[model samples]
Target: MSGHGVALRVVACGKTFADGTRALAPVTLDVGRGETAVLLGPSGCGKTTLLRIIAGLETPDPGGRVLFGDSDVTGVPIERRNVGMVFQSYALFPNMNVADNIGYGLKVRGVGEAERKARVAALVALTGIEGLERRRIDQLSGGQRQRVALARAVAVQPSVLLLDEPLTALDAALRERLRGELNRLLRTLGITTIYVTHDQAEAMALGDRIVVMREGAIAQIGTPRAVYFAPENRFVAEFVGAANLIEAACNGATLALPGGTLPVADGALHGPATAMIRPEAIKIVPAENASLIGLVDSVSFLGDRQRVLISAAATKVITADVPNAIALAAGDRVGLSVEPAAIRLLPGDTT
Candidate 1:
């Protein structure tokens, strides 16, 4: 952990609108020094609203407190909080060139011209915007403008960096390319950062710990693998990744399915149970040697792997990810094999 990076804590933080609509419920979270925490969810899930509260752009309702390391900053305003922010809109000055935009913060701080120029040059180099320093904001491409925005935010070297969908403005290819670059840059900076985005792929790519939000509340918070493979509930399972769900009455210790019974650990789950399985966990084999039989409804070649949609496997269509080399066509009867450990059982009905 970098000494310059600060840990953040929020205690019982929440918000409500003027019309009395609660945009966020009381929630608490922590981000360690030099850690990157991603707030991920759909629109209106309160991820952005929470980011605003932490950035000091919005105040929480009473009885809430925000802390940066040992300092309580709930009453602090945005500028005094020493937080750097990046947004999706590429909020750069239209008339300013890249160097001016990057050095604007240092210049505002009354730094010497020599130091300001040195800092701006370093940032321009660090962000790979070297030759574009003299280019006006309008002359830069979307990705270049985004890089400039990041450089501007980080030039101040604040304790915390808050990014709100910073890559959302680019097209899919550019977004993905910039996302990779941003991930590398963030790792190099090692600043305690909080990122907001609805894209699960971005969350998985950049987040050290993902805070999955839904309906203004946190659904689950954990490492990417933990949240995706060992979700606490059905919503977390489906939201983090594609999940194949099976509703079955547990006959003793086993779950009865379409073609055969799936053996589970003793005392694993009883009565009516829901089993969540990832598409990649199912292995395609000869129908005679597998647990379930299904007819392939469709097959999509997804470059590295093929996704085959199986009909009449469980309650819904069972999608399987197999290697592209595995020859399978639509309407072919196939057997799906799932490891006992891969099947995550959820007890009871929807709680």
Candidate 2:
């Protein structure tokens, strides 16, 4: 489908409700043409609010501005903004068949009946729902319904697509399958898209760039690799992935952990920092090396890897992912060593 190409620019965007609750604060973001940007954060962190502002469903505060290409769209209404939205509920019309549902927007725009039918047919084929075009909403499975909703959203050939936790209702296996399909479809369509989700895994898997939002503000924005491996702060590190944060005190050149003294990277010897390490970054060894002695508290198998929970200090449990072949039961003593370069230091105030 062909339509007007557009890029989005959100400049100093802020959102505050009449009840005096500030949903988002002074946020600025730019989505390049045909790029997919994912807004990821916990609930009530303003990711959804920011998305609404972009969709023109929620107006930004006076100082903020939303631009679609060169036109300022902050004051535009939702329908006027050539954007399509997919909600968590899939929001299908129970009374309409898949073809009618997909063609509704085009019909409303006064397009010829023949053109609408042709467009809907192409969308049904694109979404792999040709036979199901006549099916009612209640007759479709969750995944099928989701595809219909997506097809409907794209039927209008929107310049920007906004999705709010669209796959959160699906089961784990189905969610994984559809996530891959959605990523491929979005890339093929090449529409500038903004997706909002609380699932960090989904964000990491789908986003060309992940924007990490904190309470009412942006914490960091980067590619999935940079956001996961080089988080700017402790909140981003812990929120994006499972980070084993060890308490450490910096002393010029080295960091003192409860287990042992870990050498700090050059110019990173800041005072009172937490050493962040991924569970997979910690290796299990039989001999005592530069390691921490811990007693295994619990072990659980997760298909390919075993999650070993070890206790190094009182009430402090460290998680490590060991290969399933390395059998170890609870109460077994082990040594855990991490690569020096894998350590990341964040301020102690990070929570």
Candidate 3:
């Protein structure tokens, strides 16, 4: 909290290995001051590469630049970048206790004992590791280790914070719990944070804006709601959330599907088109009043909702999420209705 977060700019940044392997295409992005931007994609999508470039751990290609506010840090090394990094492994020293680990960075910068102690104590309380000051890194639980790593990273009051899948090592429940806690901590700290994660849920929860990356290139960048509801491309639509890509022929206002006709939000000129609908958007209705009818292929009972897969509604199997109270089973004939606004027309052919 002592250091002010600066706006970060990555200008036409690209990366290529020595063997001529291009890990990332040139990407230009701006992260506003105290903004939390998440670089999200699948494995090998170069999200980590981009983060490393921003951290000054990996240099960008010629003509690419990384800037912190007005300062060009492209040529700066990680040690001189005034940034905090938390890795998937936490990377705490096995020999160091919690207090020592949190105060290590300040000590390295030649801060006196009294100041280090005060800083360490404050961070310990901030990260909720109050009673673990003397606990060794190896003696803590995975969650505790994660908290310690975070405290250590922020203790130096870095201008920027970079986290690379910091919660990937935890159990599912713990990961979910820590995500909320982390979100709160980040907002409280008001640091310019760039987080990298392959998990879309994590990205949605933490990112003020999500940068969706594909094999070395950015597919889309938008707020979680924007990307989830109006994906710019097929990859983003399918990756950010569960989307049902339906292939149908568009005739102005309605799409002619194999099962029946569905209305579109727009009634403009169109031919064959690919449309996307979220599972929760599809509502199950009485077959007599519905235009689309299908036989249920499978029903998965999730705690709060039921994932119902219906066939014959479209060219492909259409999945829907209905309230758990609604009884549904395989082989049952069901009617499906969706609001026209919920259907998004995506670019590209119906293939």
Candidate 4:
């Protein structure tokens, strides 16, 4: 249940296939000891490529280095790197029982039976698969199999843990349930962990810091709140969460749109600028006193809140989340108000 985690660093790592397709651009990242860093992005992004490089499964381009604590592990094979890996497929042994699968890593390393059994027992209890130790792989449920895979990976007491979409196989409800458990388990083990997933919710929940990648390059890297609230670009803003990308003309003090103008936090910003706003930040107000007004294009009731799409507010349609208590429907005119602080000026045009 406990193991020391080594700090990990990757310096200018890039990857190119034999067919001359570049899978990853140069990426340099550092993961603090015992910290969980999530690499998040859409498919075909360089997140997985970068992970493969760090895990020693794929070699980085010339001059790149992968370091484990103070040791240079750039050239070391995965077996010698002492890193634990859990794949999307779970990869448990069908022929082995739960206990046997958990202990397989130790047995391969020539560990004594007494020590292996002790480690396996600890992991079984840690993963909440106590009575299922003797169960075959096919006999276990999806969640149970996930825990077994996790237990087997950590059984070797690896210096670092690498997980590639570990929960993608589970149902939505089960995925969410196990996500909380995994968060707690990772913190308890204190293992320097790198997780790759396209699910922003998963990244936000598990990562101490998130590295958002796109098209073989890193788009942004920061804490979950920072990434969500202050994205560096339109891509990060839209990908991390629900965002309203507004195109307007800035005249040093306010942003001018077709409906009305909004006060800007920075008066020095002039000319065309792309503004990003979260749906929750927009408040519904009386149209007569409001600066911005738009006609409701659609409304979707979500139990606790309503998602309202409005047009004629900015250069593009905007979405706002309002309390379900507010009665709204299509074709209704509403006013929108946002605090200056809630408006983030993103670089480049929204287009």
Where is model 4 more than 4 Å wrong at Cα?
349-351
Candidate 2: the clashing residue pairs are none
The per-residue C-alpha lDDT of model 1 at residue 8 equals 97
**lDDT tens string, model 3, 229-289?**
9998889999998999987889889999878888888788499888999999999998888
Candidate numbers sorted by lDDT from highest down:
4, 3, 1, 2
Model 3, CA-based lDDT: 0.93
Per-residue lDDT of model 1, residues 1-351, tens digit only: 224679999899999989998999989999999899999999999999999999999899999899999999999999888888999897998878899999888888888999999999999988898899889888999999999999999988888999999989899999999999999988999999999998999999999999999999999999998888888888788888898888876765677876566766545456888888899998999988777788899999999999999987776788899988999999999887888788888754544
Each model's RMSD to truth, in Å? 1.6, 1.9, 1.3, 1.1
Error of 4 at 264 (Å): 1.8
Query: What does candidate 4's lDDT look like per residue over 115-196, in tens digits?
Result: 9999899999999999998898999999999999999999998899999999999999999999999999999999999999
Where does candidate 4 clash, by residue pair? Answer: none
Specify the poorest-scoring 10-residue window by lDDT in model 4. Answer: 342-351
Query: In order, what lDDT does every prediction score?
Result: 0.89, 0.86, 0.93, 0.93
Poorest 10 consecutive residues by lDDT, candidate 3: 342-351
How far in Å is the alpha carbon of 60 misplaced in model 4? Answer: 0.6
Candidate 4 lDDT for residue 332? 88
TM-score of each: 0.96, 0.94, 0.98, 0.98
Q: Quick one: how many clashes does candidate 1 have?
A: 0
